[model samples]
Target: MNSRRTALVVMAAMLGSAALADWARPTIKVSDSFKNFKLDAVFPKSFGDWRVDENLPVIVPPPDQQAQLDKIYNQTLARTYVNREGARVMLSVAYGGDQSDGLTVHVPDVCYVSQGFRMGETRDATLQVSGDIVIPVRHLMMTMGPRLEVVTYWVLMGDEATTSNTQRKWVSIRYGLKRQIPEGMLIRVSSINPEMDKAIPLHKDFINQLMLAMPENQRDRVIGRVSVKKDDSRS
Candidate 1:
């Protein structure tokens, strides 16, 4: 599906579901499992070949748009980093303690289109977190006027990656049944590149490098694999 179709499908699913809005209230809190969960402190500013570039500018939402974001997100972080080769990537993250919005609406697919950017179809993809751990993700190709940007993103819910709205809703309902409220973190990586082939691998490497630098539990918050490993160990 194209961006418009994808956006409409999600919006329809959201607006049509009265049950979701009512039942989606978080009952129990599910911690991110990190001692002190601070996005700025948790994620490294300089990792591997990439380092924070003070001169680079990342996309900033208008004041009105930021107001809406503030309501949903407890904390938000935005930064631009440059690899040694001079390539730059933008990272945007939003964390909410009770992200039981039925299906998360704060995604690039939804918000980018709303912001006048022409997003292409959002495709399902995978990112190899380590030697064995792989996580599902969504890739977006967007443009506004003469600029082209490629994005890779995923949402974390209860140590699981929820890339689709249906997946997000299912995660919420499952946790709600247990009287648990799942925390949510939307991690997005974007770069200005016309060639997606080149952009995606760069994103994967950048994320893998960054995650490897973090502790296992802290890393799983972004990639979602804490319980999975524990379950594997039990076997």
Candidate 2:
């Protein structure tokens, strides 16, 4: 009996030691690397026909809402852009160093619902900024009383853009398994237009033109470079 009990204790100690070793593994901290880059500089102030609106009233969330957002995000940027045609687009970007499940950036769907807006149709979309570059985005329609708006947004987990909560969580887990923590950013653009057909295409054009004006490195962070794999069997 004494020998059996000793063996059991030894096995438990070995398992605990293995668990500790796993937890102590080194991780590539992407957030620290991003600290040197400025998001404000990443996006240009004026691009093509669109220019930043200086007179537009700044959007301020209610105190409670602002408090909640402050807890999740480390940095945020909000701006309004107006084109020569009098079209205006509201842009919001929020970044968080810790992209874990608890500290992840909230999507427009959740934010709208919290602010008493009814969510309409939502679908995944691909934005082709150029012939060779494609970025995944989420398209959503939100309405509250007479106010209706169309929104296009995406979330970046490290270098990958993900449109769904499940995808975001999966990416987080993949990094965690690799013993790394990934930073995340939410990029959202919205316009007050009831015509979904016209609004969507305009939004896409705005995104494409804006991307063209950004630096190559900055653009990649927003829309990742696609890797084409050659078929091994063909060779």
Candidate 3:
């Protein structure tokens, strides 16, 4: 009788422990999962032949002057993406206007933040229309946290040259929460079909909430780059 009672007690204890483990959800340390990104470009060469026309007032801005513009434009891009309710984010801008004509800039797509486990993401969306561009793996690795290997894919679009610019990215990042994120929860941080201003709202709310939950100091650490729309309202 004593032996039977002891075995039953041991089995019950094992079952209880398993149940407790099941109830715990996987979680990521706020410090590790957070980061920001930034990128920008400036034009120094005169569009000598590409100039709009002699009659046109197109003239290359002095290097120093261009540098000043860089400072301002880069800051604007950062403010648009990173300074949100206190979240580390990335900002990127590419500009090259002919004095007489306009310049076409390609903006890399902003990847979506997934549930934090499993496959990061795999799809394409319309960001801007700038014809065709490449994402490249090396760049993708930089944005994704150091924990996972980088993956690449190609994205193509037509007509919407501006939207195409930011829609294509080359890297996919995977991360975890319970210290062991199940393969099922992971998602990609990129764009989807039907490029339109309205698309921004879908996941923006969730990301903002995540940022709000993080500590203030962590929020201040701006890390990555962002794509800026000349018309802030459209972005």
Top candidate on lDDT is 1
Q: Rank the candidates by TM-score, best first.
A: 2, 1, 3
Residue pairs clashing in model 2 are none
Q: TM-score, each model? A: 0.82, 0.87, 0.20
CA shift of 1, model 1, Å: 61
Q: Candidate 3, residues 77-163: lDDT per residue as tens digits?
A: 221222233322222223221111111122222321231322443333322212122121111321244343222222211111212
TM-score of 3: 0.20
**Candidate 1 lDDT over residue span 14-87, tens digit each:** 88696676676555688644437899888899988999999977667899899999998888999999999998
The alpha-carbon RMSD values of the candidates against the true structure, listed in the order shown, are 11.7, 4.9, 20.8
TM-score of model 2 relative to the true fold?
Answer: 0.87
1-235: candidate 2 lDDT, tens digit per residue: 9999999999999999999888865367767877776678887779999999999988988899889888888788889999999999988888777777623447897888888999998877677675556667888889999999999998887667878888778877778777788777889989999977778878887888898898788887776554223322210
As for lDDT, the candidate ahead, 2 or 3, is 2
Model 2 whole-model lDDT (C-alpha atoms): 0.80
Candidate 1 deviant stretches above 4 angstroms: 1-26, 32-35, 226-235
